[model samples]
Target: MDRRFANGTVNAAQTGSGPPLVLMHSLLSDRASFDRIVPTLSESFRVVVPELPGFGQSEAVSGGLAAVADRMAGAVDDLADGEDVIVLGNGYGGFVALQMAIRHPNIATRLVLADCGAAFSEPGREAFRAMAAASAAKGLAAITDVAMRRLFAPEFQQAHPDLMRDRREAFLKTDPGVFRAACEALAGLDLRPQLGQVKVPVLVVVGEYDEATPPPMSHELAAGLPQARLKIIAGCAHVPQLQAPQAFLSAVGDFLGRR
Candidate 1:
């Protein structure tokens, strides 16, 4: 089930057998972030969960997010084999998927952007710059808690101690250089102008309690896209698929199930 594409620059796990559905993980997380929902989704689609460039077994890419997006577009194209595929991205992955769709207009037939936005507010940009600086100066350890807080609310973290531990371990495995580079790219990123280029339908979903990207960001993303609908998963933060898998699935079911 493990496969390499784009000349082994991309690594992914494949399952099921039907229309292709690619799952891209967040910058703070790895491919495992989609573990909760993959099994069910695979039943209806050939699920391809890829580790974004510079994450897990995938090789890193330079030239900022656009370069990263282009690299992923190659991988998706290889996986799609001529047929259009569906791309679902979470958090940072959502940003990458959005850029990929923009740069490669025909790469995906539809998009599921979860907990991401076309542009971050000034304060949000400052946050990424701060994280990059802090991590570069002292390493990822210095901002581990901050990263975890952004991913999950304090209450949720407290309620799921074991899952928190697993998530923390996963975050620690991220390459520090890759983390800093992504942070810098996100800090300077603004994809709103390119939203018009994406002709595919998009399902923009966010957690009602998400603070990292927030609901307004998703609202703006949905409004900017040519064809997009917004959905808010109640009582969850970023990474709602991990926090509340059933609700997350319910939010995207209709869109994903459509022919």
Candidate 2:
């Protein structure tokens, strides 16, 4: 949980026991974001959930994509102890996961991307920048309404008011600069060309109701790699890990069990 990395002290939580599996949360979210799903995953594998730079107590990457990706890779490499790793990244963390796969395909023995967009979604990019800009100027409250409604499925919001409250508070907790740079960098990434080089098995999970990165996006990511299995979960939105834990776990667990 406490170690020095990227030339600074990194403070994050690590748990479970089995093969090491690195967990990264979505944008505006941190390691604690997996509090609900950890119990399930911890049963099968050693889970390393870190507070990504500027998301929680962690620091931000000083440079751009190269810098951030390198910092992430370094953190993993340092803490990994040279063991094979299964990476599970959700949303923005999925972007980082993809980069990790491309940057070090050998280490990422298995990769799982949940609701991540490969090619830039025009509206999504615009929305990300707009929200980042809003948060930078007027603060988080500027775009609170849209973020609350769009982050989850309609049915989810209605069924779980308490979760929505927690999510909102978490969003506010994110450092604006990291959020902005990450969003901007993701909006500009095009990994379609590099995915073919990845030799690791990949699992693509998408929420049926994910308007942000819909089934088409998952299909697109799944299409790029020769070893990817795509699954679309019903009644779930962007964050299926929390919105539909059982179904989500079933999909991911089944894949991990096999490998």
Candidate 3:
């Protein structure tokens, strides 16, 4: 079922029972973002998929990356029962997960960052700014095409036309202001200098054809962290969990299961 902090700053979907495993969604996604893989993940651990502020049923909370991290850290604590837990984050969620590890050390016992990098390069920051500008000028409809292209490969887009339409509608429904604020946060974020502080084991997975955060970016992320390994899912784009579920599950399951 769903659980919300008394203050109402966080809302999460909790299931199963065992060592905690928290799954964080992408920027534009909700708790259901991990629905396809949750059953397998929950079989091994109590899985908590939290809908970050401004997404799904969760209410928006003010702040930048650090502030967002604090809210997510609180959710982690509420679910972990005082025990360190594994955190798996995709896209924007990955960014928040890194901030959690850096800002509130010891909260996460293991980290799996999917389709995300340590920091955005100059061009990447500009992309976020441009997206914010376009969205602000004409709402989410203006940027949905570009966002979709960046999130998926052309071949995949061509093959899954209906899914593309649904996702486009989903984007259009989100408040442009909230989406813009998130983009601005990404534009201003620079985590490269602090990667060394993340000592917990990390698994950095990137889609083979991710246009937004490419393999090179994931390589940079893996190289920066003190204890990190990289994995690339073939024939996949930005959303491996959706595009290559088996590969994604295998990578994450092996990492969490290994001694």
Q: After superposition, how far is residue 63 of candidate 3 from its true place, in Å?
A: 2.3
Return whichever of 2 and 3 wins on TM-score: 3
Q: Which candidate is the best by lDDT?
A: 1
Q: Residue pairs in steric clash, candidate 2?
A: none
Worst 10 residues of 3 by lDDT: 27-36
Give the candidate order by descending TM-score. 1, 3, 2
Pairs of residues at least 3 apart in sequence or in different chains that clash in candidate 1: none
Task: For model 1, give the 10-residue run with minimal summed lDDT.
Answer: 250-259
How high is the lDDT of residue 91 in model 2? 82
Top TM-score prediction, candidate number: 1
Candidate 3 per-residue C-alpha lDDT over 27-108 given as tens digits, one digit per residue, 9 for 90 to 100: 7655665777888877778888888877777777688878888888887887788876999999999999999999988999
Question: Deviation in angstroms for 18 in model 2?
Answer: 1.2
Q: Write the per-residue lDDT of candidate 1 for residues 37-121, one digit (tens) a residue.
A: 9999988999999989999899999999999999999999999988869999999999999999999998999999999999999
Off by over 4 Å in 2: 1-9
Model 3, which residues run further than 4 Å from truth?
A: none
State the lDDT of candidate 2 residue by residue for 89-143, as single tens digits.
Answer: 8888888888877877676788899888577677777877787787888987777
The residue pairs in collision within model 3 are: none
Alpha-carbon lDDT, every model: 0.94, 0.77, 0.85
